[model samples]
Target: MSAFDDNPFAESAGVNPFNDPAVTQVTNSTVESVDQYNPFPATNLASQTTPASSSPYQPAVLQPSSEPTPQATATAAQANLLRQQEELERKAAELDRREQELQGRSSTGKENNWPPLPKSFPIKPCFYQDFSEEIPTEYQRVCKMMYYLWMFNCVTLFLNMLACLAYFTTSSTYGVDFGLSILWLILFAPCSFLCWYRPVYKAFKTDSSFSFFFFFFVFFCQVVIFIIQAVGIPRWGNSGWIAAFSVIKLSKAVCAIMFIVAILFTICAVMSIILLKMVHGMYRRTGASFHKAQQEFSQGIFTNKTFQSAAAGAASSAAQGAFQANN
Candidate 1:
């Protein structure tokens, strides 16, 4: 009865489950581990918080920027502008120098070479002539031909004088022809050069309508004179075909010479006609007109220093006379 009445799960007062050898061993080990383990250690905390060096603490300093400053950038831009301005000024100076050189060459720099006389000779060259420099390439051929024609005419006149001298030896009545031949040579050579040749040269150089018109008038007269010389009129100071034929009875040499002169005159007339046509064609292409020529003539007259001085003097005299008359 006593054994059945006692509970099977009742704890025994002296027996503790926690006081068992295995449980006591586990509790002792856990207590020792809990004491040894520390979440915050002195060495690890110091390594994390402190710097590697032993130097004193200082404030952080900012390094200089690699980018250019505003002032520096502005200075660079100004320097570039100054350099450009200097370059422009240098170029302007060069252009001015070139312009001055051109003006000098065009006006007074070059010396006269025409009439090509020696330095030791009494007479100096009277004109400057450079077809290649002053005249256009298209007009050079015509200009040179005209110059050659002038030279040829001079030669013909000299030859005519010789022929006339020979004829004079044949008869005293031919003295007038010899004298007139000398006169013609002396008068015509310089006059032709000044009147027709110079006018044509200036016309080509400047493309002046006034010069062109002047050349046409003078050269036309020259052509007519050439035709008259070719006609060989007696006592007219010409060695024409008739004069040449007449001289044949006197001296065959004189006749031959006069015939050559007559032929030269005919050639001059024919060449003048052809050249006139050519010049006229060129003038038409140049767009020059009578109105332009008139303007140019008037302008030239007004701009002439001699004309201006004369006009001023005349006005002054007229004013003085009127004032005296009124007084």
Candidate 2:
């Protein structure tokens, strides 16, 4: 019974399988290998596998962009030049159209429209005046104002004649005033139109220095004449301030009419001064000078066929007379 209870396979007291050298060595080796080994290593397998002649692994880096090529820069410049050429061509076409329009107008021999009289009237229009066609857009306003001023002056002159006629009725001593007023209306109206007004118009239209100078000279005289007319000196023919007040006691109706004429004269003087200043300012802006005026005047004289013919006839007549006298 004792032998059966005691087994041969059973371990002795204090002797453990786990404490054995072989088992302990195997377990320690496994733990040491686990501690030393690393699943994620810093070493590069590609670098190690590659041959010595191959380059080492490196990170990709972004490079700075290179400058534009000369051909590409030239292409951009050519595009700009082409755009400028197109603009120049467009401007040239516009200028050609304007020239053609001007030529067409001249070639058509357009009828005069100024004075705007009816076809039934005996006196035909003497001039063709179109502000829209002739005058530049920038100068049209001032030019139109000048035309209105001329018309106003004409009306004032006509009123002055009427006033003088009434003054003559008041007294026979003022008969000369009435006569002179008629002469003034006949003379100054046309003279003023031809002299200062026409010169100024030509100045603005053609930008002519000669025309500008002529206008300045003639308009200054006109302004002086206006002042003299406003003064209304006795026997001067103008029914101005002095003439109006002189007839106040004789006939109040005549005095009132003369006073109105005097007022119109004063207004004319004021307007002339204002327009003169405005024209002077515009002249300064236009770069007009006495030298340019002289050159333009000489050119105009030389270019005129009438002047050339007169000069030639005079020269020939003078030579023939001298030859005859010598003979």
What TM-score does candidate 1 get on C-alpha atoms?
0.67
Give model 2's TM-score versus the native structure.
0.65
Candidate 2 C-alpha lDDT tens digits along 20-54: 88888888774547568888689987776867556
Candidate 1 all-Cα RMSD: 15.8
Q: What is the TM-score of each candidate against the true structure?
A: 0.67, 0.65
Model 1 over residues 1-327: C-alpha lDDT tens digits?
A: 878898878887556688788887887774547668877666766556766465676668998999999999999999999999999779767755644544344445776687899999998776778999999999999988889889999998898888778778888998998899999999999999999999999889889999999999999999999999899888887898989999888788888888988998899889988988988888889999999999999977875558889999999999999999999
Minimal lDDT window, size 10, model 2: 98-107
Which residues of candidate 1, in runs, are more than 4 Å off? 1-108
Each candidate: RMSD:
15.8, 17.8
Best by TM-score: 1
**Model 2, position 302: C-alpha lDDT score:** 72
Q: What is the lDDT of candidate 2?
A: 0.86
Count steric clashes of candidate 2.
Answer: 0
